[model samples]
Target chain A: MRTAFIKSLMSLAERDPRVWLLTGDLGYSVLEPFAARFPERYMNMGVAEQNMAGTAAGLALSGKKVFTYSIANFAVTRCLEQIRNDICYHNADVTIVATGGGLTYGTQGYTHHGIEDIGFTRLLPNISVVVPADGYEVDLAMGSISGRSGPSYLRLARGGEPVIHTKPIDQSLFGRALMIRPASDVAILSTGSILGEAVAAADRLTAEGIKTGVYSVPVIQPFDAETVAALARQCSLLVSVEEHVTQGGLGSAVAEVLSGLDNPHARLERAGVVHGISPNAGSHAYLRQLHKLDANSLVERIRKISNLSAKRSVKIK
Target chain B: MTAATQTSTSLARRIRSHALRMTHAAKASHIGSCFSMADILAVLYGGVLRFDPSRPDWPERDRFIQSKGHAAAILYAALAETGFFPADWLSTYSCDGSRLGGHVTGHGVPGIELSSGSLGHGLSVACGMSLALRADKKASRVFTLLSDGECDEGSIWEAALFAGHHRLDNLVAIIDYNKIQSFGSVANVLDLEPFADKWRAAKWSVVEIDGHNHDALHKNIGHMPLEAGKPSVIIAHTIKGKGVSFMEGQLAWHYKSANDEQLAQALTEING
Candidate 1:
């Protein structure tokens, strides 16, 4: 995913002279191509995230399309106020790029985890919150927001994420949920890098004679409210899953929309890292398994919810 | 062009008077902060900056970021009088539906480079602007006005170090060393003693001056690149609430707004 981002960004830079990249001493091997090609537009802003964010605002204020890159924790949490006051307050044209979204840097420890970034950046006004699912999605998101005005947070997974899209995705269609498999009875909506697992869950549920729909929602803020509402009306049961905290990420966004409806009928349940920060360190897959975010665990939870709702419906009849 | 057309003393007085009326009508605080930096704003707006009110967004215009944004009254006063907007807008300050927010806002408010109420962010943004100009080979400079109390922020020193390392000669930071901050005196709260030495050690060209001294400011600021290839910082020694006799050096004024009678007294004194 990171590789795809760099490739897309470099092409954007070549096309637009105003595109400037500032990294907080990260992206060592990945960002050299841009630096080599457009040295005037590239800035390694040292280890200061606050200064880097402010600098991105300054550059953007001066008619430059600025992108500040770093690990998710450093990029989002460290200089949050800079993002708030300098970028969002001014509504400067800047993109805050956070590589290693979620626990993509797991085993490196809890400090590197990006569990809370989506929730926080989503709360900031005048900023877009995007969590691209894979490399292809990365290209789609970059192409869309690289030129768009106003600040945005692009939460990227670490490189080598599965190629989710088969062909070039259009800009307008990127923010809305994409259906991996369309079925009517139960719809499984997932976000971030966990979309691949959602596709797998849909496949397994279909084999068991359970008709399910799978969707990948990359944009968290200004989330596809219309689609969420339509999906709620269409399905009997809705399950929202993610590789982030359940409170303010994909699940919370979906729940907020569903709850506000004029007495919607879809039964809603959420699956995420609900136990809070883990004391023990683990890899990405191990942590997903522990958090019940893996395909097998998600399938079990979906089946349980589907069966329980089925029993309730039979009782009603 | 050598000295500002509007005498600095007169501009300073107008700022204080406008602030007295604005704060009194709005019942807002930070009157001390506005008074402390009134003279500095006067000097900057008094022919020191390369900008036009008609073309506030001119690409070549010098950038100014007010880091200590609580003093929005004085900034609005300067912008209004200098033709950025109608002086009538001064009456609308801190009022709802007015472009002049209690804290500085950039949107719809002409002549403001960036909106800042957060203490430590303006310098870094100024540094970024300076860096961009240098990269683009533009002659425009970036200036940021900071409060002494704001130095307590680690982000300030981070920006200081960055400016030095980048050798952003096009950047200038003027610290309103008015002694007092919100909680207490700057010294009692957080000592920025040896402040000049700190900037010098960080590879900055430091100049200590009386913030109210118009001649010194015009001479020093007009003379750019204080030392070639290094950022310049002016530690302008000033008094909190400098203009009004009753308010000068008083910590209460930091959070106290002028009452009707007090406003009358302040405006009377400032008329001179």
Candidate 2:
């Protein structure tokens, strides 16, 4: 995903002279292509994320499209005010690229976790929160983010995540959800790199005779409410999945929408990391399993929710 | 003093007068913050900046960012006095639905490059503008005004280091060293005693001056790039609530809005 981001950004920079990249000294091997190609437009802003974000806003305000890069929380939480006031309030053309979203850096401990980034960024006005699920989605999201004039937060996982879309994905699906499977009894709406786990979970659920659907929501803000609502009406249970915390990420967004809908059919189940920082450290797979975000865990959680909802319906009858 | 210097001095007086009235009318604070940097705004808008009132978005115009954004009253006054907007607009400052927010904002106000009230955000942005202008090879300069109290923010030094390292020669930072902060004196709160040394160590060319002196302001700021291949910082020593006798050097004025009686007294001293 990191490789995809730099490649897409490099192409955008090449096409538009206004595009510039500023890093908080996090991108080492991944960003060299951009730095080597656009030396004048690229700057390693040292270890200061606040200065980097402020500088990105300054550059954007000066008619330059700016993107500031750093690992996970450093790109969002560290310079949040700068992003809020300097970038978003001013409506500067700045894209904040936060790599290592969620447990991708689990081995590095909780300090490196980006589980709460979407929660903070989605609340800010005049900014788009885009959590792309794979390398293909990153390319598609870049096209949408760069074409817009306002601020955007591009939350990406670290490199080597497989592209889930075997078919050609349309650029128009950038702000909307792309359905991987048709809805039946239950639907799973996933975002970010966790989409792979969601797809795997859907396949297992389908084989178990409990038909399931999977939708990849790349853009969290300006959320695809229409599709989510339609799916809610079709599926008896709608489960929202993300690598981020349940409070302000994909689940919270879906919950906020569903709660407001008149006569919403389906019951929503939020699946993600529970609130509060974790003390345990392990690999990405280990942490995902611990948080019940792994494919098998997700399948188990969904089956339990479906059965409970089925029992409740039978009681109503 | 030259004609320009005299005009700047008068401009500074007008800024102080307007600030006193605006703050009093809106029942707002930061009058002390406004008065301290009145001369800096006056001199910049008076002559140093190359901007046309009609063309606020002129591509080649120099950019001015008020990093110490609480001083909005004075900055708006400076813009109004220089014809960026009608001087009558000064009366609406900080009022409900007024464009003149308590903190300096560029939302509807012309001549403001960036909105700021939070400390330590301006210089880094100024560095960005400077870099952008340099990249475009445009000669337009970027000037940002910061307060001594505001310098207590760590982001200030982060930007200071960035500007110096990048050799953003087109950028100039003018620190309004009024010596007072929200809680107490900057010294009593958090000392920036070796302030000038800090900028010098960051690879910037440093100049210390009296912030309220128009001649010194024009002499230093009117010239560009105090040194080749380096950003310049002017540590302008100033008095809080300057031009008003009672309020000057009084920390109470930082949060105290002038009453009807105090406003009259302040106006008399300012005009006198």
The regions of model 2 sitting more than 4 angstroms off are A276-279, A314-317
lDDT of 1 by residue, A148-226 (tens): 8999999998876677678777777867888778958889988888888888888899889788888888888878998
Residue A253 lDDT in candidate 1? 93
**Number of the top candidate by lDDT?**
2
Could you report the DockQ of all the candidates, in the order they appear? 0.81, 0.90
Per-candidate TM-score, chain A: 0.96, 0.97
Best by DockQ: 2
Give me the candidate number with maximum TM-score.
Answer: 2
List the pairs of residues colliding in candidate 2: none
Superposed on all Cα atoms, model 2 deviates from the true structure by an RMSD in Å of 1.4
Instruction: Indicate the docking level reached by candidate 1.
Output: high
In model 1, the runs with Cα more than 4 Å from the true position are A275-277, A314-317, B1-6
lDDT of the structure predicted as candidate 1: 0.88
